[model samples]
Target: GRLVEWGGTRQIIKEPRQEYTNALVSVHEIEHQEQKPGTTPFLSVKNITAAYGRSHVKVLKNVSVDIYPGQTLAVVGESGSGKSTLARAITGLLPPEEGTVTFDGRPLANRLADRPKEDLRQLQMIYQMADVAMNPRQTVGTIIGRPLEFYFGLRGRQRDARVAELLDKIEMGKGFIDRYPAELSGGQKQRVCIARSLAAKPKLIICDEVTSALDPLVANGILKLLLELQKEENVAYLFITHDLATVKSIADSIAVMYRGEVVRYGAKSQVLAPPFDAYTDLLLSSVPEMEIGWLEKAIKGRRMASAGN
Candidate 1:
């Protein structure tokens, strides 16, 4: 046995005997287990241009972006500015009319039928309206368990256990397992939707205004939970929202869209700072501030400028 000093104090301890040494070896092996490097850009959009019809009302114009591991890229813009269209394009709900979307180094084909199940599993989406996204007839367990079963082949007790784990991860108790979506509140429903997306173990998730409908306090809680989950799971997020407040809280980078084009794209600090583009400045100024007279002053200024023009 060898003597070991205890902290900075004078106390000493004897080194492990054979049994103690063996236990320590086992503990070290368990603690040092190799972890796989986190997933990289599961989805990539390169110079993508999407349109609706022959007249070709373009919703995305030469848009290019990458979603890397454990990062949130917030796409912010005014209404009809093509934020949701960009999300749909990434998820393959709408194929790009021009350019390419690559997943895991492979370009996505023209049709969903050409895409593999693994590719589908690697990408999932959490839509804005929880009530509309969820089925009223199904119980919470069924809604959350379906993706686990589809992607992981989990069934019976294994599936149920996974669902419970997900619920716990989303900060919901097991008591809601048997309840239907109709029984839960807006925030809880959204949480269940999030758990369902996580069930597939996706590398990237498209969150389309997932917090806009909720109250401020509830939205903040959801944003905090999402940030925690990003840290733990190493999942990339394409957070599409009109709310700049939400972007400030969770976005690592910002892509400012205007009329279907990426006008400004960069790190949060750089894009949100002074010397912003005129549109970006307008968007930033629109966010409600704590000061009482800001809105009135902004409106008056806009009116004066319009009259001058």
Candidate 2:
């Protein structure tokens, strides 16, 4: 067992109760267009209420949030909490029964076909399973190059050069362009997916649990790559996931979803800090730490709370 001492544990738990410190954390002014006095949101989902049916199954209930350019608004929740449904609704795969989604000051049609060609080209999605998203018959070149052809009409030498360039951006150089999905590693496949989305020169990308399937190291790489790409491209992301740790790692802002509602929404530092909502407190406590006696202490604390209740 590694005997590690958290020097601040006792101090933080004791929490000196200093009004000045509390006020400082509470009033930390986050800079953004949304925070600015008069600037409008880059992307706005206003009162989005979505349902699935033949039978009318309600998945999202009047959910709303704003996303800024070159930032991530991570939607985090447990399964069946309607995380994926939100993504589908935004992309117009599942039309919201009520409310509207606006991007760049213009309203988008809730159905894919009803939306303009520019809207389709500018909004992209990366699924959780990269293997399933990729076609086995198509080589990496075809998969990544096709989007460039469709969106920009680049062909032959131009297309191949662009494809190789994209491959390089994803950390897979020109040599790997000739390889098929089956020949690539899990991380490589995910990188190709990123390149494919980038090929569209998208304004926004709906990343639906893009890292959950990868190993910890691989996932970290993907997250780093995405952040680097975002800084270079100035693209926004509506990143969906269940992991709060993942949110803390990469999200600029966070929207915590519970039972089809956003219980908490704010900047990453503020949301992860103290004075969390009840469900949020529980959610935060659930994240495991690499330390001794954590589970036992948590169990005892929960037992005491339950007994008090």
**In model 2, which runs have C-alpha deviations exceeding 4 angstroms?**
1-38
Candidate 1: deviation at residue 56, Å?
Answer: 1.9
In model 1, the runs with Cα more than 4 Å from the true position are 1-42, 303-309
Task: For residues 230-272, write the lDDT of model 1, one tens digit per residue.
Answer: 8899888899999887788788778999999999987787888
RMSD of each: 14.1, 7.9
Candidate 2's residue-wise lDDT over 1-309, tens digit each? 653333364443345255543332222122222221125677899999988889887889999999888788899988988899999888899999999999999999999889987898899999999999999999999999988989889999999999999988988899998898999989999999999999999999999999999976678778878888988998898999887667777788888898888899888778888998888888888876544578998889889978998
lDDT of 2 at 78: 89
Candidate 1 has an lDDT of 0.83
| Model 1: how far residue 166 lies from native, Å | 0.4
Task: Report lDDT (CA) for all predictions.
Answer: 0.83, 0.84
Cα-based TM-score, every candidate? 0.84, 0.87
In model 2, state the lDDT of residue 58.
82
